[model samples]
Target: MDTCALFHRYWALASESGYGDDLSGQIRRSHGRRPQHGSTANVYHGTFIPNGLEVAIKTFPSTLSGMGDGSEVLAGLKCIFREVHIWSKLRHENIVPMLGMSKDFECTISVISAWMPMGNAYDYVQNTNNDPRPLLRDIASGLGYLHGHELGPVVHGDLKGLNVLVSSDRRALLTDFGLASMNTSTFNMTVEAIRGGSYQWMAPELLDNCVATTESDVWAFGMTALELFTRAVPFPDCHSVANVVGSLILGRLPPRPTQESTQFRLTSTWWEICTSCWRRDPSRRPTVDEIAERVGRAMYDTAPASFTASSHAYAPTMDTMQSRLSFTGDGPRSAPITDNDNLLPCATLSGLADKILSLSFSPDGTQIASGSANGLICHWDVHRRAQVGPLSRGHQHWVRSVAFSPNGQWIASASYDGTVRTWDVHNGVQIGSSLQGHQGKVFSVAISPTGGGIASGSADKTIGLWDVQAGKQVCALVGHTDKVQSVSASQSRIFVSGSHDKTVRLWDARAREPVGRPFEGHTGMVWSVVFSPDGRQVVSSSQDGCLCVWDVRNSSRVRHRLEGHTDEVTSVAFSPCGRRLVSGSMDSNVFVWDAQSGARVGASLRGNAGWVRCVAFSPDDGRQIISGTEGGSICIWNERIH
Candidate 1:
């Protein structure tokens, strides 16, 4: 129908229904006595003058009618037209049915619906003694109907606790559609108005790029469910909008509530469903139908025991006497392990004089290079599980980072002696003079995928780029306010650096400048950083005992936030297939995680005598994980162990 005809039809219906009476007087005499303010409209309790049937009158803001030109006013009218057209046709039990539209309110137009005495879903759950599972199921059912409409699917751009109202019968009904979109036609609303969603409940994709889809709505549903159960806003720890944006950019979901009463506790199955809805990949999220079915089943079943509590029940003690360890394995490059998999003792290579601080695997995966506190670099054979060559020594202080060349011919080491040097791996001799540019101690170094460029991060708050073939400093990029702790270079010559400033910055080696905004999620100093196999993602470890996986292509989107370590996470490395990650921590534990799901793979690998300082995955097969400890021991684990 045309816009003018639709408006006249609704206006005629309102006139016949006697909606022209003053709503303010009717609201003052009604049960609510005051108007309720929402993001898009103001709702007041009122009554139909003819039959005295109670109803709610929703009026748009008058500012929308006072734009610079008349075009904006016309657009506002068209928006109301579209919303009324869509909302009036919806007939599901969980959907708030539209009664009529009126022009007698303060704004140019108004919408009327059935009066919900129980208020919004958030208030209802907080004030009543009703079971939240039935409300959650009602919400899912309403969303499912909108998405599965036979005419054309509709996307509820805003799905949160505030948008759902509870009826007198305790049924949750979805209300506002100001930000919704219909597949048949587009609304004439401004971009700012359309993107006006609650930031805490928004999906990462929507926060990164302000485009809302059905998948994004699913993400909001998960946050809404969390709000109902916790009786608080999403991400309750975040204090402001900036903090919420930062958390969402880092793919950090709300941590499970620890103090919830037994009546409101979230079961393991329900939490799993919520996490599945918040997956980083939009296609991986479950459909509304699936969510409704899960909630329905959950309502009738007994609450299961906590899965997180049982996963960390056993902690192994340190054992240093074993020289060689073996385990039953499926094969090389087997599927990623699960929490049920058993962890066995692994081979231990000992002989270093002082603390082992750094580790790296050769491209062929046969040889491993490690740097120690006494400035000694040693090479080891994986199969033989012993030292391979004479120790290479030159630095005057502790060696902090080591990386192998692409061809496995040279090893680059960064030291606290304020220099970076390359050593010939085969003969244990220095390749060239030390590359000196930083005024402070160098903490980390990485070789580019092509093996021609080297990036070094130092305590001087600068990153030095060096030419490996020329053995000279190319340029120094300075931006960090604090010390740079770790650096990793990708195949495209682009690199990422984590700093003591508690931020992660991306740099283009060729351009010699920053790429985008610094990733700002970690609350503690960043300790380590590394790029995934495809160079599309970067995983960073921090002193906060957490790991964040970021999408390199878009700095605003973080793929996951891994939280299991009990102490400072010292190092992180991606497997060859990019499906798994290994991290070492000061807690003297090593953990393996599913890179995609951000779920802990199995029990923590224990037995390190002291703090774990470095970790790496085999470059060739990804089956072997090597970790070095402060007590001068290197352990190799087979992740495919049965």
Candidate 2:
């Protein structure tokens, strides 16, 4: 029979039998060698018949007869097809380019892609003298492209050294999209099927929730970096998967390699980057862009061989080593501010049991209240730089937010326990029973300027108006379609709420209804919101890494779009004078911006050991800026006017 006729016959037979053995045979395996085995698929070195070019043919086990139940086989086929569809659309130098596909392979399908002669990252790095920094940079660049794709962010469900292939030119290209997920409708794999990946590289949250996200991918990237550096899997000491899972659950990351290697040494700076990616809170994990920048800088700024295990031996440039001393006790408690244009580190406040998630200054600015992941709220005397009273403890879960009442006598705290509570600042004790109305975790709380009322945003997608004196919920303001992340009350009766739905809404407390059309501009979840000192404008920070200033009087009008942060802007606030804005981000840096022109005021303020969760300007005069970080320490900075 003719070649075209033979191809048609094989296609028909494969479709009928749910097998593609005849079609797959067209790509002859190189010397009939055994295929390289993987968790989901086996890759065979082969030559494409049509193009007469070398290629890698990846086949799944489900393509074979009797591999599993009919439904299971069907799911496997769907996953393979989904991967092909997604991979075909991606085009990047560091990402493996798709060639073609063989249909009905043995009863499933096979993916064809460019063959990498040098093999995977782990094997290549182990056998060759090639510096791994370039390969690491390639991986980061590829991952960043996938995340920042124009269509939608694609999450590589599994990222490990094995999935990174090195071409003949020693360029690392990311492969294995079988477990990837995209925001588009092309992804149809069941959560259970796609959730399973290499355990040692998985994020802690993924083990419990079984949901793969970009943040989880970042976690895996950190593990992949470890693998490339050590030439072994993550947690090499753990003999079994259960041990690795347990360690990750307890927030234990892979220990830093003590022994230095001639091939590549893991410096303290690189170790810091890896740990940042492994932060317990996924939202606090550094973005791929930030990772790429750091890795790129390290590649160019310092030679790998020059680094030593001793923290003091390697001295990176000031620009590269933005802040080697962390407030988390890694070094000196406070470092002198090196740049005149940046905020000067004046004091470092420590003692929180866990990461500080929220912070609020007293009306007089003499005291500060901080909420922690350990469910405790601590009061600090700003001048004394010490805890003022006993820790306030009532919430059973994470304290997400805290706010001081206008009178400076009471502090309102919102928690993940689905409750908001009031505490007496003087005694640091819960004043009443937990105020419970929301059906979900309360993320933020703001007291009215008069201190008589309180507003709270919750995961329930509803804003609660609470009567502080009565200690009860007054009404539920419903409008948001997703989790309400933040809420702020203006001097008037106006209140603003930002939600995961990617919109900001204004509410009139007196009427208990929305004031105008939702202020819509952000493309990601709104993480924080606050009103200007005059209450005429609203400032919001979002996961999109941009802040929006909305005119309260004209809700639909966005006054300014401030963009500088390279990662999720976790929190933002206006200076007491309302002339400037301060923002903290998962990038571990704080920035000051001109409130009027939406321009960055000075260099990024750096020192936080982890994600900066909350930033606030002193209500007294805005001369001091305090930022709380996921490292469980607070940094007080003197704002130097440029």
Instruction: Go through the candidates in order and give the clash count of each.
Output: 0, 5
Q: How do the residues 373-411 of candidate 1 rate in per-residue lDDT, one tens digit apiece? A: 667787877765555665687898778899999999999
Residue runs of model 1 more than 4 Å from their true location after superposition:
1-352
Error of model 2, residue 39, in angstroms: 4.1
- What does candidate 2's lDDT look like per residue over 1-642, in tens digits? 133343344345434543222345567667767789976788888887764557898887544355566555555555666677678778887899887667535544677788886689988777433446667888998999999988799998989998999864346999998888788644334434467789999999888866799999999999998888788898988999889988987888777886465243567777888899999999999999999877754542233121111122221111111122235534233333233122212122332135678999998999889887668887876775655666687888778999999989999999989999999988778888889999988999999989999999998899999998898999999999888999998889999999988999999999988988999999988999999999888999998999999888887678999998877898999998999899998777788888999988756766524458899999989888888765445767765432
Off by over 4 Å in 2: 1-352
Overall lDDT per candidate, in order of appearance: 0.76, 0.77
* TM-scores for every predicted model: 0.47, 0.55
Summing lDDT over every window of 10 consecutive residues in candidate 1, give the lowest-scoring window: 343-352
RMSD of each: 23.7, 16.3
User: lDDT for model 1, on a 0 to 1 scale?
Assistant: 0.76
TM-score of 1: 0.47
